[model samples]
Target: MKTGSLRFANIHLQEGPIGLLTSSLRKGRLSQTYIFAGARSVGKTRLAKTFAALLQCLEPVTGPDGSAEDAPSWRPRPTSDVVSVGSAEDAPSWRPRPTSDVVSVGSPDACGKCLSCRRVMAGSHPDVTFLRPQGAEIRVAQVRQMQELALLHPYLGKWRIFIIDPADRLNESSANSLLKILEEAPEKVVFILVAEQVERVLPTIRSRAETVLFQNPSHHAAREAIARVTGRPADEVARVYSLTEGAFGAALNLAAQDLPVTGLLPLREAQVRFLEDLERFSGQVQERVNEAPSLEAALAVVEDPDLLLFPPLLASRKSLVRGLLLAESLPAAFPVLFSRVFLDVLDKARKGLDKVLETVIARQKSAYAAEILKEMDRQFGMAVQNLFQAQVVGLLECLRHWNEDLFHFSHTADETWLLNLDRKDDIMALSLVRGLGFAESGIQLLSRSLELLSRNVQPVLLLEHVLSSIGGRTP
Candidate 1:
């Protein structure tokens, strides 16, 4: 969350990898290629950038012993304070200050004030390049282009750093091309491949690189850090931590958005009340089934609209879902009621999309022609579709957690292990009614739905199938 500086000391809870990289730099054993592997938002990319900056720093801070130290925290200096490292004609005649006057390199950190350091931090460095997925995959052409760039000398720094984020996104041809570069990488060129799921990376590429694994900080550490940064109550930050499952980046993002932690309490209370109503309704349905003269009557009783729909609960659930979506902190174990909420959003967006497109076209028509307008409309539609798909994926994660809780609670009866602690009674009742088999089936269904969703299955159909199957309306 700290801006301006990318020093290793500023990074939270990544001491091991930081030490390794800094030591390697000090000992002149730095690897040409490194795979920084970790879960999403655990500081892998930040560390990569920092390392790159240090490698290319004009006047890297080093200790008396010629090793990097835990450097002092850096703040952005005025443009006048930035020390330029350029050609002799334009560069200032500079010399290193005495060790006592400079920061001690106990292991060397970037001064973060030099022209090279500033450019790298601001993502404007000519020699530093970041390669991300062009669409869903990093294409072979990108790697080929990078290969050409690699053959060139560093533009303005000591090293040419190429960072491929989510390196697992490299498709087969691209990965092969990257492997060739790694095999015979040019001098002073560093390739840092970052991956959340390292297993997805090609075996040859993984084998060629030195891998540094990053782990998430403990919940307590993460909560304290987030609370300190956001200046929010520890208790409030704790709730946000739980919602993000201890991802520091995600917690910071939610805090930046001023997540409605207090409002969540009311949402939970509403959810509990709705579940109680549902439990009671289930009892009534059972009684009706017992009294019914035939299977058709019993089935009709179970499917009644009044029994299935709780209008007040639906309204409360919709508001809560929308708020969470806006905050980008939708809770794990988000209730199954999200199916109805998602359908509602889908319907509204479908109805309004054409009108929204027309408005955009009208505003742009003076500047763009018919073909441009048509292409813009197509892109806008794709963006909306991608947004809807992302929402479905988020909801699927929540349902996955819900089903996991059901499975665990059914086996162990341990509320402490459950993500939805507030929904204990509801989960217990549902577990008993649906049984362990249902929980297992629900988990499988959600997992499959997620996999299918990645293959471009219709989001609406996926939700409908999941809701119906989970509700015992489908086999």
Candidate 2:
């Protein structure tokens, strides 16, 4: 089959809620209302859109008698970059050859070449409507408009499909209005609700529709699907899969980028210094910025290669957390290769952790620990930065990632599960320094620093306190 023939809905319909849709289609038991539910970025909206297109297809894959038949093209023939469906005559007449066997659940479908399908796919179909969140919630007015549209007969297609994306975003008034439609919607209309969190949707709404559960594709499935679309190398496809948490749409976004995402230049140096300095439990992390304009240098080094890195000269605290998570999974560790370099420091940190864990946790108490982490996270986001504070957060985030990996390596002895698989060599080298005990304390040290920063503690003071608490040199 040619590449474009792969309609996403048909890909794994044999499994999960998709299987039910296929069964319903074959048995001619289609639901007027469907709720497609799943994790974020796991194809809920894509599935909903494709299903809506199918409902609007003039010659759907399933024939009039629901018999096995030639599937019509699911994609509109290339006319213009913009869909701008002009006339029915403009649709290409290419039809997929019929299969003699009973139509399988995997039947390719939703021929897009037809005028009706093109209009729906192009989002120009007079009968199809999509209601999404305005800002944080889907307001009542949008539902009223959709309800008004539902009363009209099909302008050019068989069904009037209203798709509510992130269905959970529907406000109370909107949800009640939607419930009214669910109770007595027009015969030719279909309602498809796509949501990441099914629980957030009103129960009244849920009771009136067929709930279809979508799922995240397996790593292998993600790799294949993305590779088929992008025609990228296997390694590149795998990398994208890892980065996007296996969401096809998210994967497609990054695959379109000019280059694979590498962290800003300082990410590398900062990561290296953080890991190296931990071995000494010293003040070297600050030393990297000791030179004037060095902070600016680090900030400058954070170039925008592809995947939006902390926005131009602005790094949100949220981005730092994301960067740390990236460091955990994607292996950005560099610079630290020799275990001999930081052995003494790692030893110092463990002893210091023991002493401080008692004193600080006692003096500051549990409430302080809980409150500080939130404060540090909040402050990092307050302003642009007196001096690339967000960049500093990013650096420490990388360090935290290293400590996590080392802790996992020493305790679990499973490198396969390591997030820094690319930095396996460096991690292994560092793993030999004080093993699990020190790695655990190192994690605590970073955690404490995060909390300390939240308590209106100066960054330098926080760094020095961590160093001292962890029994490290201050210089």
Candidate 3:
């Protein structure tokens, strides 16, 4: 294994799976299909790609031909102990040898410098295909296309590879189509199905493929791996590690940014300010509703908060109405436009934070000489694109944390689990005012909104719906 190779270097904390793969390669016992099951962002896909590259590498390093003595560090089990692929056995139970018996070897790996390896890593090899969800599914059409391609011999490599990412996203039709391929895949063809939830995969498909489990690395291990890659301070890497919820890929991305970790301070402050405003406004609305004599009067009082009295009300009814139209359906209390004001405040805050980020990037750029300014500008451009999304994500994360705290606190009556300890009084008051059901529902709504955001749904609509539902829920 070449340590300098991206294929090897990028993989973290899956020595067992890697050793099994290398052993199979060394013994010429590669399975036609494999199910790499693991949590998202845990390098299953990365290892799959690396394996694909090795399978097609023009200069692979499989040590002395099929000789156990050549590689003294590890040895395969006897034939009697090995469950042959496609045998009448559970996929999960099939193991070539105990992982403890398999050790890492310096051979049976891709020469990442070879042309075939480079092409595979770059995702340009004709024989290597990556099938991902086409707008939320691996459609039947996509699978059929892959089937056609799989029939052909390797265009320029030793084996043809098809990697289906998030294989659980395959709908019934597509999954059945893929099942057909797995049943009788052509010689020299490899199918790697990467799924986060193996249970969601079809039983037939799971039964056909040899399953390789990839476990999530410990946080401390992840922090050290990311630090080694990013060469940043341990504290900074740990902070990014926690912020990304132990997601290795996301942490690496954040660490790779040229902007210092402290550069996010302004963004955090802005999010905190916006959230505070929302909390304060929610309290005021609840107070006004409590004072009203009837539901109608309460709606009227909350919606028509006197701008003179509440100097911080930044959005007008017209703006609120415009924003509400973005949502698929008007919230139950459509007339309660006060909640929409928070959206306006959030927009202003985002724009202000954008400026602050731009200034920071500019200062960083200034440190570079003119010759590299073009490269710096390109890097900053990418950073800017990520910054806008990060800002929205950051706000949503805050809300998510708050909602989670509320839900857990309601269930357990424990303050230790609360992420925002400073907001204990507000959380307690809201819990009392809204009840447990609201907290649960709020978490679901936030979760759905976050998922939609990832799918490129309009952020404006998501924000509008969340604000209206959470802030405008009648007290």
- Candidate with top lDDT is 1
lDDT of 1: 0.63
The per-residue C-alpha lDDT of model 1 at residue 178 equals 90
Instruction: Write out the backbone clash pairs for model 3.
Output: 61-108
- The list of candidate 3 runs beyond 4 A from truth reads 1-4, 62-103, 243-245, 261-269, 272-475
Q: Candidate 1 has which clashing residue pairs, if any? A: 62-105, 63-104, 63-105, 67-105, 68-106, 68-107, 68-108, 69-105, 69-106, 69-107
Better of 1 and 2 by lDDT: 1
Model 2, 270-363: lDDT tens digits are 4354444343322322222223242223222221112123121222222223333234232322112222223334445434433432343344
Candidate 2 TM-score over all chains jointly:
0.55
Candidate 3 positional error at 429, Å: 18
lDDT of 1 by residue, 271-324 (tens): 454444334433444455456554324334433323323223322343333233
TM-score of every candidate relative to the true structure:
0.66, 0.55, 0.58
Q: How accurate is candidate 3 locally (lDDT)?
A: 0.60
Pairs of colliding residues, candidate 2: 73-111, 73-112, 74-110, 74-111, 74-112, 75-112, 279-345, 376-454
For model 2 the local lDDT of residue 467 reads 36
lDDT of each: 0.63, 0.54, 0.60
